[model samples]
Target: MVVYLPSLTLFCDSLWTKKMCGAVVLFVFMCLTATTHADHHQPCHSPNMTGLMNVMSLKGDKIAQGTFAYDSMGKKLRFRSNESYPTNTSLGLDLLMLFEEGIFYEIDSKNQSCEKKKLQMLLHPLDIPDDSRFYTTMTAGSASIEGEGLKINIWTGSIPHMKGHYSMSVTMGCLPVSTFYFTETTTLLFSNMEVELEIKDPHLLVVPPFCHGEPVEDTPEGTVNSFLNEFM
Candidate 1:
């Protein structure tokens, strides 16, 4: 049942359509700046609720790779994101977050250190039709994938499932193109999905033993903001 990701060290994780953690951050930002940020418009349909899966996202020269695992019965997720920047040094950021426990771990792969902090939020994408202006404009079309045309629903505006200005694609049966979506232009592609799969790795739910890092004492809001400020 464990899908071995041979590319885990490189961009194996970040081919998702949306950045799950980024949306969690954006939702917080939207809540904080509600007075300044207007809805893209409103939706006429029910909002989309997120469950979990594995996906990758590509944006400009930067690459965000992550694995989003969810336990629907338990109502939480085990996730990680590695964002790579196009620099001579090829700087990158690696992270891991476990819901339900409210633990956020930032892994310094090179230094082999990790920062653990207490932070928790129900990270799920709920895109109400009116959450953004373009929610109503979402059009359903057939996108050719691997020479096969599949019926997909596409929308522009801030991502509906999570938050941010990304185009989103939803396949039939209400499955999101990936686990995350933002910027309609950021392409979200799927590599694997185990909707009925539950996370079994205990290590994924806690800080690794190899990293000698201390836990940070902070509120969920405080810790989440600190984590977001780095990339957002």
Candidate 2:
């Protein structure tokens, strides 16, 4: 069985915006981001460079746009994502990546609701006789790329399908600019990575007002959480 967990491949959301072209199906394309941090629940210093970045997808459909900031201690991110539905109606599901006690909150600003889930180091299962082909190293010019730096050399590939890595840059540190959901036959891309080296405001990482009074189902300790909805 193939298990899906919040690794790197999902990117659907944002801070300072509520723009989700809700059509139910767009929710199928919804992606949540949870990357490596120094520690969760515990407070830490912000990364050297912190700034807002744009999230993009190939084939016309676009994910939510958001910002990210990190430090030597931990990281914080927020975004909303959706596809072009004919409704002309926009409903963005806001998310706040504030991890506490192995948990973080995914919010729906439109509904003024929030759901929390645990942070797990998720792995994927891939079937390939030559596993080496799934990995590669490259360096190029990323002047227009977000988080672009002196050189653009990084490793990228996918574990079957989930946890698809699309972008990686190392100027100040090893930073993952974006993720993807693709098979050997299809592909998706993320650009304008916008990596900054600074510390972000700690208060901004807090959950928004919408999630203030919402109840949540917590992920039990040591459970393999395939998705946040698993707890929902």
lDDT of all predictions? 0.40, 0.38
Q: Give candidate 1's total backbone clashes.
A: 28
TM-score per candidate:
0.43, 0.47
| Model 1 regions more than 4 Å off | 1-59, 66-68, 75-91, 109-112, 118-147, 153-167, 178-202, 209-214, 217-230
Q: Positional deviation of 133 in candidate 1, in angstroms?
A: 10
Residue range 30-59, candidate 2, lDDT tens digits: 321223333322111223444433333343
